[model samples]
Target: MGSSPSTLERHGYTVVRELGQAVLVNSKDGDQCVIKKINLREETGKGSGNTDVCDAVETLLGLSHPHIVKHKTAFADDEYMYIVSEYCSGGDLYQKIKEQSEKREAFSEEQILDWILKICMALKYLHDLNVQHGDLQPKNIFFTEYGMIRLGEFGEFNERARQAGSTKDGALSYISPEILDGKTHDEKSDIWALGCVLYELCMLKSAFSAESTVKLIPKILNGSYPPLPHNISHNLQQLIEETLQTDPGKRPLAGEIIWKPFVLSFLTARSEKSIDELNDNLVKLRALADGLEKVHYGATVGSLTGGVIGAAGGITSIVGLILAPFTLGASLIVTGVGVGVAVAGGATAGISNITNMVNQSTDRKNIRSIILEFQEKMNSVVICLQHITEGMEELKHQISLKNEQQSPSGGTIVKVGTRVSRGLGAVPELVRLLQVANMGKVAAQAARAVRVAEVATGVFSAFFVALDVFFIAMDAKEIHNIRTTKASEADDMKSKLVLQSPEATDSDSGADQEPKSETMKFVKKIRETADELQMSLDELKEIISFIPKLPDIDA
Candidate 1:
């Protein structure tokens, strides 16, 4: 092994190995530790601020928290500052996410909430101390044994880097829009970065992705990203939306995020109950009751309504845009008018749902009946969801068949009404299901019941987006079909010419073909739609997992 840095060597630390950005060292006391070597020559070369750099490193040694990495000591030589912190054996969050991404697996919603809450708690501690982690990304989020989060690589090192005009440019994907816009870093900016982290944990990819920093700046400023995988909870999705808001003022502070109803309830359930207690559904129910007691019932209903209306409106708007060109300006006008009407109708429906919830809440004695009724409706919704998924799968199969058939003449025309747009038929069914669940939520006492309802609504919302994409995919497939037909005609002519040649053999007849851009585009659409639908189906199946097995009742 290479010799330890002089700063570490003075402390009787030997270099065990070199890590990517730090050194793994063995202390004389027989403990494995990490020594982060920060070069201080650049800052001191200006002939000042050496004392300030030392003071910054010293401050981190005094910081302590359950979720913060434990710093043992800090010392500096003339050229470098070395800080020793406890080594986290379980690796970091970035590695875990990368592994899961490679495996094509996703973290469960409960697991995601657990991780984010721990991170939020750590962040709140830092914020309360008037400290901001200028650099917060998955790589800096370490984990101890049993997967407890220990925030690392924070404090003076980050501050110094920021002062040196190096604010984690490598982690541009996680940088907040405000920072990209040249605003000073603040706690709110940390919230924005955390949102990016949260999105990564859920989707296994950076929320904002681009080929270059120049392309990425506009993306972050615009702050629009593809939706989270459908298997993620709507509440979680909503939380992410709030956190990633481009307007720093709108983002929730770390403390407020910790206290959100979903976070609080989920954390309580995990911390307050043993696996055995959770297995006894009634105990789980009791725990859920206590957790949700702090939740605002009306707000929950309102959020559900908001999600529903937002999804419906987005779908209608997309539909209008898709059909606008066909009608010239008339369809655009109609779409504008239709969207206004839909918004009005959706608002009225939301108010009605809230009113029903209020009326139902007054009758606590009817809780069991209310849950049973909700459960019954959920059964039907589950069947409806399955039917919809199956229909989409069949539609995909039909498209695949169309893609495979090599017609020399014009390709078989898709039936007029056979477009994936017909998937819209499930919208009203889903709406009615939401209304029933809304009524059930008002009267139900258990968080599980509420979660099932939320998941159902989330499935509907995800499906709506899928339906919109499905339309675009169908259009792409139509173009692809026409192009393939023309290409096939040319190929058929070539094959005929080859067959007429005296020297032609089976091998001679085969020619290598170049990739077609339209075919690739269509294939990409197919993959996207399939992936999207599969993810949504996985989310829908989670409802089955959430629904408890009730005792059989006498007829």
Candidate 2:
């Protein structure tokens, strides 16, 4: 946007349109993209500047996902840097929504659900990588050809600009209350924005619309909004309500939202396929966790045994060289022991939280509470794993330093350190595997909880075949009871009538036979449905059990 199309052409892109500070461009290969031009010197307020923008762009370039608008490449001239990314032809969701509103139309329930699901999937992906989309709104949601949506306009440039003390514009209505109150935001803030976008889609207006930002802040902080239409389903109403809670802790995570009854009802076949793939990934993760548990246990035992043996052979004599291997081994073992204890504690807390969640799931009010606890515990587990990995690396560095020291025992220490390093080398990889497994486990549990809740709530769809069977059986039982009652009354009447006339007996017999036949068919249906429901419950239990049980590291 800053440079002419001819200037940009020399850099290999034909400018199409200017979007804010970014310009839409077409390459020689006919690839359409949006190029963000950053004037490094102007941004840094210097004659020449560092490569912070360049480094940030490189990080963004590494991110690739279906819902995330892909960053293709980056290059820079002396004064300006250009970052290129995929361009969406259908424009942004905000523009589309504005056009629809102009036509006096609101997005249907199915359309809103589809867009929300796609956005949540992208947010979940980014959150897993610890990247927060600080600015999320309808304008950031770009529609591709065929109406597929991708999240764009992430705050990378804004973030860098802010670091240099520049102001960045954001939509006030879509910002979370926490952010408005001068608090740092995380993934939950994005979820809050999601709630606002969804509300707009349904109502054809903003939830916290105001004449000015000054008025909007008060409404967001107070969590006030126009009530949803009475015709909106209770499930959807509940979801939006919880997401817009003023307290960030009360909001359900992006991962948890996917499993809500309202969201699950609109899941497409492709969504189911993704769930299956996720299931497979979780299974692989559990196996990885199992292997890591074993390694952790082995390392702890090895460290403790080595330390005791080394201490027993005193290091106060010339024979310390003979005991050098034992000493080095003890140092490595001590490191492992420290890591093991931390991991064990974290695992124990996570299990406790999960158990509480499972127990309290029936209480809708308590669902958010349990999720908050679970999220906190999982965060602790991740921190513990990260610490363990860092500690192992530090241990390796220390051993290397020791090996460099000039001493008669240096050779022995080097030899022992090398062996120990090799043994502990896999610790980082194991930690990484567990971290990934934990994420998968969280998503799986959330999905399972949703399915179970659907059955309990009587929302029977094709996806819930077992639940449908159970409901059908209940309906048959009710019909059978009604028919049986009618048949009994007819028998009583027939007894009275037979005393008066023999003709009534013949007619009553046919009616009585029909009721008996109908009752038998209904009974059969009830039995079949009951069996199917049981099978479904059994299958669900198996899926829940697949959530990897972290070893009692505390023990």
Candidate 3:
């Protein structure tokens, strides 16, 4: 515990105790808190920004899972930080596990199962937000005196941690395979650790017990999970197997597991508990969505606002879009950054349609199937670019029109300033809506591009077949006429000979006609060969045409 008797006078702390690298204190109202101060002056300064602190606070605020700790408030002075969060009077899980071990008992089956399930909910929530809690273990989990579990200390979190190596400091037995193999860590790694914790809770053992980090890494990368007792339920055994899988791709996602009926049937069988967990998760997600909206809006808006102020003698398109004042709601626009909403209007030009776009979120399934998926997206990008160009042109004209109406009073420069302010006041919502449409186009492109190769192959194959058909059609009439004419000529010659040589005998006529019959047969075969060649050509061309004509989606 961190209770500094000396600094307690100034920083408003009556008590402090050093807990590892952190300082814990008792609030004036008797509430417990911890302060993990970062010495910015001594940091590695990866980017030399307060992003580290901002990211930490944002992550803590974003999680709403029951297993995660809730941050109350965080404010910093030049020297140290004061991060207030829910204090678990029951203390950390490690202490509880130790106490239980001393009694020659392990956590009950239900308690372990319940805790693991809660952990899954928390992990699912963080991943949904694209935020990751890199450090997870029994110590990070706290059991409240009120009979609750809370995940804590997620301040140094961000999109970056979602990948791995966010920090060099980490635990061993719970480490992910990627981490063990010198690969970047991601949420899958967290799942691996969750498996480790689950294993310990069940077997009362670590997944890998090693003397040092150096030895632990290799063993984890190739280690086998400790054998489970036969008494463990088949359902639980399967769940453990999925969680401990070495291949990240093969591991089950929280969504994939939580929805299952048999994986942990006992937990779900308790309808009341399951309902509570679901409700708690919903509350957490709503909170995170709110916080993220604010963070993203604030961080991205300053630049856009700055651009508004920097308008000069040249560009008018921006001025036009900025001149119309509009209300930017949070669901549609957070601090000026907006999302898509469903549009009631059928057309793109109306305010209702723009409003709909501002309210929408990116759809995920659109990117899965073919190569045209790629080209189609690219083509959409091109269409967006054209729209943007035209929109910019109209914007310039609007700016010019507004400026022209100003009186000659004051001067030209005054006119410009007024126009600049006026434009800044203009259709912010509209511009944001346009930005969102472009986003749709962007999404469409990404999904389409993902399947570009597949689309191309299919198109190419179809094109070649179409060409073969066309060539066969062109040759059909000519070949048929040639064969018919040749047959008619052979019959006519035989008839004329018969009429002019009425007196000739039957044996001499039959012998003389054999050579002529062979010639007609050869002619008919040649015509048939031509028809066959044409049919093949048509097939080849049909396949050829479709191959290179893949869809082109825009960027």
- What is the per-residue lDDT of model 1 for residues 436-526, given as tens digits with 9 covering 90 to 100? 3332322232334345445645544553353344333433443344345445654563445334421121123232332132223322333
Every model's TM-score: 0.48, 0.48, 0.45
Clashes of 3: 78
- lDDT tens readout by residue for model 2, 63-98: 866577878988777777777888777789888888
RMSD (CA, angstroms), candidate 3: 35.7
- Runs with alpha carbons beyond 4 Å of true place in candidate 1: 1-7, 46-48, 155-169, 274-555
Candidate 3 regions with alpha-carbon error over 4 angstroms? 1-12, 155-170, 263-267, 271-555
Stronger candidate by lDDT (2 vs 3): 2
RMSD of each: 30.2, 30.0, 35.7
- For each candidate, what is the lDDT? 0.54, 0.53, 0.46
* Model 3 C-alpha lDDT per residue in residues 1-555, reported as the tens digit of each score: 232345444555554566554556776644466655554333335564576666666657555444567676666555434455665656886677777777878677777867777677677777777776677777888865444567765524422222223443445667788876788878877778788888878777677777787777777787576689887766567678877888887676664555332322333233224333433433332332333232222212212222111122111211123211211111222222222222342111222222232223211011011111222222222222222233333333444454565656422433323322232224554333333343344334333433442443454345334323323332333334334544565455444433442112112455335322211222223233334333332332332222111111110
lDDT score for residue 474 of model 2: 32
- Model 1 scores a C-alpha lDDT of 0.54
